[model samples]
Target: MLELRGLGKRYTVHDREVVALADVDLVLKPGSFTVVVGRSGCGKSTLLRLLAGLTLPTTGAIHHNGGRPKVGCVFQEPRLMPWLTVAGNVGFGLVGKVTKAEIEARVEAALALVGLSDFRNAYPDQLSGGMASRVGLARALVLEPELLLLDEPFAALDAFTRRGLQGELTDIWLARRPTVVFVTHDVEEAVLLADEVLHMDGGRIIGRREVPLPRPRDATDREFVALRRAILDDLSGRAGSSPPPA
Candidate 1:
């Protein structure tokens, strides 16, 4: 499990300190899927960065149940190298730590997992937006991390593509059971994907609501619609009542 104790982050811009995250506390249990939803600049991405140890917090601690866990991340953009093939990008981090054969095996398995085995030899410039995103996901999976972090990984895809990828993500999560934390601004997407949805605003987690509706959820269903409205109201400071625990 991962625990955050009064975790906070701030930055200095032109001599003034700006708070990106403030007094934020959260606990992420193993094998659980949690999604953070908020408007832009609400510190959703910042929280993911802090959890991945890519950045330090200003005034809090992130505690793991045991030793530090292995982390993998897929960012909003696919940060692949222009010179490398899809396979190379997927296995990019394995150099010096594993043999070429091992990297090749892992890369192949990851590509298969993301349904991109046929695109292994293609260059980033040659693939479509969704295909490139798959390459990014494959790269993160190749590391076999215990904790996976995604920052709007599907925000750029077209609606049809986004739905397809979301389904694939759900399938992969159930199979691998990795602790997943996804950050997004889409209310329907958050409610559809996460076991718990957190609302962040003003650099702090303002509310959290558990999504107990059945999996493979339909966005148009009455229960799903109700949850979406409630989350929207909560985020806008109009939810009225405090949400129950997850």
Candidate 2:
């Protein structure tokens, strides 16, 4: 388990103190999938960065059940090395840390998990946007991290590719059961992927909604549509006195 207590971050912008996150508290269960959703600059990415230990928190503390677990991060862009092949990029982090044979085995497995095994020798420039994204995901998965953080990783893909990758992510999560924190601006995407969706606004988590639906959820299903609409209404301050339609 992981817990955040009164977590906050401040930045000096133009010599002015800016609060990116403030007094935020959260708990993530082992292997649970959580998605954070909010508008641009609402501190969604800041929260993710703090969780990833990319930056130090200005206030509060983070506690892990067993020391800090290994972490993997996938950003908005693939950020692949132009000169390296897909397999090389996936095993880049393991160089000198693990034996060459082990690196090859792990990279091969990661590539298979992301369905990019055939592209093992492909360079960054030779792959399409979606394939490059898969390579990014494969690189993270090769580490077999306990905590995985994604920052709008599919935001730049076309709609069709995005949906496909979302399904692939769900599959990977189910298979590996890594604690995942995914950040996104798309409510439907959040609803589709998250076990619990966290609503953030003005540098704070304002609300949360549980999704108890089964896997392979149908977006057109009444319950699915209602939940999506309810989250939107709540975020927009348009929620009715009555609960979402049954």
Candidate 3:
């Protein structure tokens, strides 16, 4: 489990203090998939960065409940190395510390998990947008991380590709059961992917909505629509009513 208490981050822009996150208190369970949704600059990405240890908080602390856990992070872009092939990028993290056999095995397993086995030798420039994003996912999964943080990884793709990748991501999460915090601004995407959806605004968490719906959710379903409506309402500052609890 991971816990955040009074977590805050602030940065100075031209000597002017700008607050990014403010007093966030959250608890993330092992194998739980939580998605944070908010407008850009609402501090969604900042929270993920704090969790991934890419940045230090100006206040409060992140508790791992014990020792530090292995963390993997994928940003909005694929960010693959231009010179590395699919397999090479996937195994980048394991290159020096692990042996050849171990790296190959882990890399192969990750590619299989992401359904990119056929593209092992393909370079980044050769991959389509959707395929490149999958390679990014494979790179993260290769570490077999205890915690995975993804920030709008599929936001750029077309609708068809986005939905397909969303399904694949859900499958990966279900199979590996990694503690995941995926950040996105898309309400429907959040509804489709998360076990629990968190709403953030102005650098603070506003509400929490749990999606108890079963796998392979249908957006056209009444329940799913209601859930999305509740999130939209909350985001708009009119949370007087919400979808009935699942």
Candidate 4:
């Protein structure tokens, strides 16, 4: 289990203190998936960065059941090396840290998990946006991290590709059972992927909603639509709003 206590972050922007995240208290169970949804600049990215240890928090503390767990992070962009092949990029971080044979085995498995095994030798320029995203995911998964953080990794893809990748991500999460914290602006996407949806506004988590639906959830299902609509309304300060459209 991982626990965050009174978590907060502040930045000195033009000599004025800016609070990006404030007093966030959360507990993440091992193998559970949580999605954070909010409007732009609602501290969603900041929270993920703090979890990834990319930045230090200004207040509070994070506690892990064991010592700090290995963490993997995927950003909005793939950030792949233009000169490296897909396999090379996936194993880039393991160079000199693990044996070459071990790196190859792990990279191969990660690519297979992301369905990108056939593109092992493809360069970044040769792949489409969705494929590049998969490579990014493969890079993170190669570490077999205990905690995974994604910051709108699919936000730039086309709608069709985005939906496909969303399903693929759910499959990966189910198979690996890594504790995941995914941040996004899409309420529907949150509803589709999260075991629990955290609503953030003005740098604070305002609400939490459990999604008890089964896997392979249907977006058109009444319950699914209703939950999505309700989350949207709550985020928009329209709680108890009208029912979802028929």
Candidate 5:
């Protein structure tokens, strides 16, 4: 569904050039959920922005097959309008394209999908942090996006809230099945949410690991333990942390 060939990005600030990404190549298949995991300043978010066309690569190309795919992005914050109600925020993206009736229907459906149907009329300030984040997700889902780009969308929530939203997100993905490229610094969250994990470092992809474990994954399982260790080693810049499962 998405392809990046020789992808690279660089910025010039005050006459000094900084490379954010370099010679990176990746392919994303239709409906696949892939997570890019790396420490801060590792270019993970830059990659997502490139895919989202929010920024252009300095030295490479991103190609989507045939027709341009619809995209929805969820940033670290809810980014909802302070004055807009929940339904208003979710339907905000549909303006000019969809009819008022269609927009209302989409907003209501997305709200229900994210377990926020009861709070449809609540304002952003009235909602808790987690509830506000769900509003962000609902706004994205209302677009019926073919590709969903999430940049640590749950990083700010409390642990329990994060976990709850993670499960909710998984169920939503399983049902809607959008092509997802999620970027996160949390290894466990990436492992639990993605079908494949890509470890990035120094503006390049260092490793690709497939998570074979079943959904509703057990965090305490032995296999999960091994995988976690391997990912930790990779992020820590260890050499050949562990061989890929044979």
Candidate 6:
């Protein structure tokens, strides 16, 4: 399990202290999928960055049952090395840490997982936006991390590509149950993918809603519609501290 206790961060900008996160206490069980959703500047990215150890919290602790676990992260953009081929980009994280043959095998598998096997030799410039984003996801998955952190990785994709990748992501999670923490502003995406959806505002997690919906869910399903509506209302200032039960 991974736990955050009183986790907070204060950044100094131009000699003033700005709190990015405040008193965030969370418990994430192994192999669970959770989504953090809120408007921009709500500190969702800050919280994920803290979890990924990209930054340190100013006033709290992060604890895990075992030693530091392997982590993988994907950001809003692909961030691929422009000159590297698809296979090389996927295997970038394993450089010098593993053998050439090992890297080749993992990259091959990851490319296949994300349906990019045929484009192994293509450089970043050759791929479309959606394909490049999948390459980013494959790069992270190649590490086979215990913790996967995604910061709105698909926010830039078109609606069709976004929906397709969402299903693919669900399939990947079911096949390899890593602890996933995804941050996004899309309420529909949150309800569609999260086991638990956390709402944030002004650097704090103010509400949470359990999805408890089955995989390959239907957006038009009554329950799914209701859950999405409740979350939208909550985020739009029409609901209470927590969204009423779905």
lDDT of 5 by residue, 1-246 (tens): 788899999999899998899999888998999999998999999999988889989998988888668999999998999889999999999999989999989888899888889999889999999999999998998999999999999999999999999999999999989999999999999888889999888899978899888998877889998888889988887897776443
Task: List residue ranges in candidate 5 displaced over 4 A.
Answer: 243-246
State every prediction's TM-score relative to the real structure. Answer: 0.97, 0.96, 0.96, 0.96, 0.96, 0.97
How many angstroms is residue 176 displaced in model 2 relative to the true structure, after the best TM-score fit?
0.8
Q: In lDDT terms, how accurate is model 5?
A: 0.91
* lDDT per residue (tens digit) for residues 1-246 in model 2: 999999999999899999999999999999999999999989999999999999999999999988998898899999999999999999988889899999999999999998999999999999999999999999989989999999999999999999999999999999999999999999999999999988898899988888999999888989999999989887787758234222
Worst 10 residues of 3 by lDDT: 237-246
Checking candidate 5 for backbone clashes, the offending pairs are none
Residue 148's lDDT in candidate 4: 95
Local distance difference test, each candidate: 0.92, 0.93, 0.92, 0.93, 0.91, 0.93
Model 4 score (lDDT): 0.93
- Cα lDDT tens digits, model 6, 75-163, are 99999999899999999999999999999999999999999999999999999999999999999999999999999999999999999
Alpha carbon lDDT at 181, candidate 5: 93
Q: Which ranges of candidate 6 are over 4 A from the true structure?
A: 240-246
Which candidate has the highest lDDT of all?
Answer: 6
* lDDT agreement of model 2 with the native: 0.93
| Model 1 regions more than 4 Å off | 239-246
Alpha-carbon deviation at 209 in model 3, angstroms? 0.8
Q: Per model, state how many residue pairs clash.
A: 0, 0, 0, 0, 0, 0
201: Cα error in model 3, Å: 0.8
